[model samples]
Target chain A: MANIKIIQGDFQQRLKLQFAPGIKAGFPSPADDYSHETLDFNRDLILNPEATFYGKVEGDSMIEAGICDGDIAVIDRSIEPRDGDVVVGYINDEFTIKYLDLRHRKDGYIELRPANNDFKPIRIREDDDFEVWGVVVWTIKNWRKY
Target chain B: MYGIIDCDNCYVSCERVFRPDLKDKPVVVLSNNDGCVVARSNEAKKMGIKAGTPYFQLAEQFPNQKIAVFSSNYELYGELTGRVVEIIRQEAPAYFRYSIDECFVCFDGFADTNLKEWGENLHKRILRSVGMPVSIGIAPTKTLAKMASHFAKKYEGYRHCCMIDTDEKRIKALKLYPIGEVWGIGRRYAARLEALGVKTAFDLANHNETWVKATFNNIVIERTWRELNGIDCVPNEEMAKKKSICTSRSFNGMITDLDGLRTHVSNHAARCAEKLRQQGTVATIVGVFLNTNAFREDLPQRCSFQETLLTNPSNSTITIVKAANEVLQKLYRQGYHYKKAGVIVMGIGPDSPYQPDLFDFNAEQFEKMKRLDAVVDRINKVNGTASIVLGSQQYTRKNGKGKADVVARSARRDACQSKNAIKQDFKSKNPTTRWSDIITLK
Candidate 1:
């Protein structure tokens, strides 16, 4: 027998969208039987609220990665970043978002590979005063702005 | 055993959360109204920037230095520190926040756990999750734990967590610790102790209980002596909670009129009530204090404080504000330039289970006020703060239109800025709290 487990998200936070405040408390409504909680973005999306932060992308360095300018990136600082993960790093006294390349760690350095061809990958030496600020979890796109 | 985790240079570290580039650089956070330096980074301290140095004196004291100065941005600090507290809530088996930057973790059930490793891992978790570095100290007593935290911060060899478990280790640490630096020992007591040749913590701890009582005749000093000797005597501060909550700040400038004083006092009282509601407590005594600038030697100076008792212990903003304003009326004096005003609420207790006064307790009205407060708090929380504030809480700042409007940080940036315009010119961006102020990644 094969034991397979599918991820099931159980959102414990329920928002009663069908009801309004100041309704008379006597005689429960028949609508109560069909009441279902509305979806909550905070509960469903943010796995770790304490470690979450938002940063706005400024340029096309990550355009090829579907992370573009004017997009909002959700970063999680608590996660231990891994190879090939889109991470936010502090380089040249500015925050840079790129794919972390750990393939060259055996040679005493790693690279932050940019998605677009116009930008060069940032090479960080073993002794560089650098750290992965956070791992990019989600990038929000504004489809139509009024 | 008890462990104390304290944030290193709390305000400076909070400012550095958004400005990652400022790490390992000279940074200082000024107090309210940018009056004086309240917190300094390690680099700034190395550059001889002393605490309480006025904002105007920084350039004069250290000429041509690249020092980053920031006005106190408590909104950013509160949000970042809340995240740290959330992390601590998950990591420690049992913990209580002592202050905005300090938390105490109790190891009552875990006898076999490695306390030092636990502290180190907790520090690492908080540092990564919140970007706020903390030093952990573990000892049998809270006082000793606080001292251990100091050693952990001073010496890199300790690796941000120092534990004093053995008697020999405790004795050695106390011998090296200064008496003035001991927790619960105020500056006056430290000075008096120094005069008696008690320079080191070991000297005070070495004295018998009889000598400590005979010389000092103080319970706090005796408790400090016992804590230094590794006996858990000092009570847990968080369990007791804050005895009194005072919401006070110096005016943007000198205010001479009673109307000006009324406006400021109302805001402070409202803030105190909001804080009380948040803490799920009520205050019975509401007090107001006003003072003239002590530095202005040319002008007449007067300072007065008056308090009034409430008919019923309450956390209602209107009730507290009304009581505070009545006290302010009695304390205000003519012909004095007032520099600061504050509202303090004392005799706090749990909001529920209070014996309401038999004469004034109105159940219907009390319930109405509670519901009203709940709605107001919800509205403010959803729509930024001060959206539904009392009219009296509005500052008497006249805009170009000469019409009164609510002055709050979330509502209008410039309107609130006009209060401390010059001093807050160097205030940093509140990236964590505001959406538009989030960092830009290039």
Candidate 2:
């Protein structure tokens, strides 16, 4: 089946009838702790002076490396990823995170390995088919008192 | 000595990876079958939400409190746990991953140094790097270390690590603790221990080893006794090689048709085989089963089990799946609304086991299988699972029911199939954040 989507204003009246009270109350506003500072959307997008951009982590491939889903990642595009350094790479436009393998193959190729054994290692053909977006400089993860 | 380092409230910690706001919230992770609670955060425990309590039951009990209920996001937990293990390996002298949320570390010698300090440093490093809170316990034996770790979990003053190097500390802690709460003492064993007047760790430890072993039916109780006395009884674990692997689940809708049941079994077999190849293991026996709901009184449930032995142990998905299907056929009977179907692989060993029937015509089939497995594995590794899949899983819920590539691609497939795929590792105070991929469905 195709992805499910409903047109805006398509069910405004029906939704209003079903959830009018909830609509008036609005979502239980998250506490100040849950509310993140709003990003300056109007600010001109700019990479760091040293070629870094903070991107939100979307998947768990790098969770083993301590970079978890939804965590903010510090990506340094300028610094070449060394062995064991986690990197965000683009393979055919799909973003992936893995440890960069510097071991030279017979054809002098490189492979990206996920920290978790559950994920298979990715071998990059010597032919320039992949792009290393940036090396991971740091990870911002959640911390809370027990 | 060998020690198991386990995280407290691992799932909740993973969730905190992103939503730091959920720190100290009543959080619980549901079991694989969406059946009951498996892991609970400290806050959840404080709320009296017991582990294995049914989610629906808990919801009824505490409908007002905003308890965070989450499905098991193993992908994220596995990833986070991996990071923790890697960091431990880098810091510790030697270590082996004991389970998804546990590891065994060898901490010997250096009495002059503070073991608690080492543990604090390790915990801080993991939190800084992986974003998870881990409790460490140092004792002379692995079993005692496990107990110490358990003590560390409940006591906030221990600074996330507990060591019971002396008998006084062990005895003091044990007097107040229930005997059933001890590791390796399950409900039945704990009841028996209590009946025998062994009501606490100290009580159990004080018992004669021979009597305890005789009462417990094995050497496990004796080992526990020694561990309590600070005698190193548990051996250092090299690696736990899986003897068998299984894949099973209760259907969202009960399946009564044999064909539908077969398809479900096939799906599980395919998954089990994927796990097999991932672990470099092969199976010699395939077991299949189908059963009706045991709780439902309206229908009488019939259950059947059958197994097939292979001439050659193989990691080939097709080989095992085909065998599992045959077993399913033998076991599946009509007129019964089967609530569950499952596949079990036994006699598992290294993948390169020799084939006894080398001259069989299927030798050519094996060659094709080798190539096919490699190609499928490669493509799925990149594009995600069901980038390719056996056509059999596509039939009607039985005739391969629920087989449409669409439903499979959208929600259910993402929930069921992606588990063994897109593996990522990380650790966090919030288990939900780590397993966000698996929870994305919710």
On the 0 to 100 scale, the lDDT of residue B212 in model 2 is: 77
Off by over 4 Å in 2: A1-146, B108-113, B173-177, B237-239, B352-371, B395-442
Residue-by-residue lDDT tens digits, candidate 1, B282-317: 999999999999999999999999999999999999
> Model 1 off-target regions past 4 Å?
A1-41, A144-146, B237-240, B399-414, B417-423
Docking class of 1: medium
TM-score (all chains, Cα) for each model:
0.90, 0.67
Say which candidate scores most in TM-score: 1
Model 2 complex DockQ against the native: 0.02
Error of 2 at A86 (Å): 20
lDDT of 1 by residue, A9-46 (tens): 44555664456534858887777776555556787778
Q: Looking at model 1 chain A, which ten-residue stretch has the lowest summed lDDT?
A: A8-17
Error of 1 at B159 (Å): 0.5
CAPRI docking class of candidate 2: incorrect
